[model samples]
Target: MIGAPMETKGLNANRESKPNRSRKEIIEKKKAMDALLKAASAEKDHLSAFPAFRRYQTNGLSAFLESGRGDKLASSVKHYIQNLLKANMEGLYGSEWPVEERVKRREMVAPEARYIFVREASNASASEMSTMSEQESTSASCVEKRGPMVGFVHFRFVIEEELPVLYVYELQLEPHVQGKGLGKFLMQLIELIARKNQMGAVVLTVHRSNSVAMNFYLSKMRYGLRRVMKFFAKHSVMRLKLSWRYVSVSTRNHLRRFIWFNKVVNSTLFTKGQNPAIEVLEWIIQFQQNALIIVI
Candidate 1:
């Protein structure tokens, strides 16, 4: 799945009529894709000690989780969804989650900001999506052991606005399925989701220090860096967009406006730390004053 995009990109790049593609650019892109493919096959090393997604069972208000790692990615994901629904409902019917809770909930449960990959597998012997409902799928299947219980992802909407623009919420693989280029294959699965859904983009946020993730997103997948924030865990927001490649004039202008707003807001917000630029100039002057250490 993850490997699918590399193949597609290679073909697309080949057919492109652009005359200014530098030899260096082509080499770099190929190298990046190769690395992505390799990582897609890695049996697991520096990555999270275990699987990226898992499952959980709840008894009343208390929830029990099971994940490859202690973090219980699946349980966390479920809780996250609950939080969003809570937020949405609270908005209309006298809230419960306060501001702090809202932020915490977002950190726990929001759909990924960016996703380099996604996979949408229908039940091999399927019914039409519209005719079947969420409950029907859950009731029909025995909680697909081949992959994570992707009940939420399988739901359909007539519009893209209803879904997260960009995200890679989870990556689940069975042991035998581990490595051997399946990750890339899974990513292609996601790409189809983004493209077919008519999403303007796909995005994922990773810890700033998560070099492997950052490399996969920015280098291999060609997702653009969108935001860098110090949210408890510093993270880089990245996006895969079809817009920048061929956006409308109005859209481009709106982006220009956003850039202007960002500059003004960020300049004001980043004004702390005593102006290092001024501090540097002061230090230079101080050095000049001390240079003529004459006893006059």
Candidate 2:
């Protein structure tokens, strides 16, 4: 009958309209998400106003810290981050991470992140030094003119494993700056920031292939490895509990002396063409321990 054809046409029209309705709903949901993210970013910007700048001086070098909000300084910060990563991690991750794509991803997630820039006090210009006190830089040129940035650390405060933590995303220092105790100095500042914010722990991820980083985080800094249930094949997570009593300043000083002593011992052994035997290392450690106790 004629009515049968009409009913079929109506059903087909309804089927077509269903997809349009669903598409409209999806667009509305995306809009809502965008709005929510903007509000959250605003809130984060408000809360990060305290401790605006922390100055760190060590080994005759000075690093000025400033909190970064993703929306405000994403361009300049991303530029620094990209340059650092390309210099440091490109070889480690291989070609799997194209710089352009990686930079884009970092910029997308950077709105809530914090940054510390290590600048040589003697080399830095007035404009570069001004960034130390400013909340956020509006121009990327300031970072560019500061000569080669010596180092940087990116971190954010988050809740993981049901506890508040300060998570370090990346810590990169130039080749010349490495082995000068600047890395440890930066980590100490991060811990202080965590304690100031009442975070329960400090967490970071390391690439297994980067043995130097692994040794630095595990042996030197005393960070414990966490079994990462879901992580990239080459990466591992490390955590340091902040809930316990702070590692005393004396202990930190002892740690620094131990690190310096080991470096000297290794250099001496290598230069003298002597095998770094277990016995020799043990003896050196024991002697250093005795010396530290005496100093204490």
What lDDT does each candidate get? 0.32, 0.52
TM-score, cand. 1 vs. native: 0.28
Q: TM-score for candidate 2, please give it.
A: 0.51
How well does candidate 2 score on lDDT at residue 279?
34
Reference-based TM-score of each model: 0.28, 0.51
Using TM-score as the measure, the top candidate is 2
The local distance difference test score of model 1 is 0.32
Error of 1 at 138 (Å): 10
Query: How many backbone overlaps does candidate 1 show?
Result: 23
Task: Give lDDT tens digits, candidate 2, residues 11-116.
Answer: 9999999889988965764565355334433444222434433444556555544445555565665677677778887786676557544553554356576666
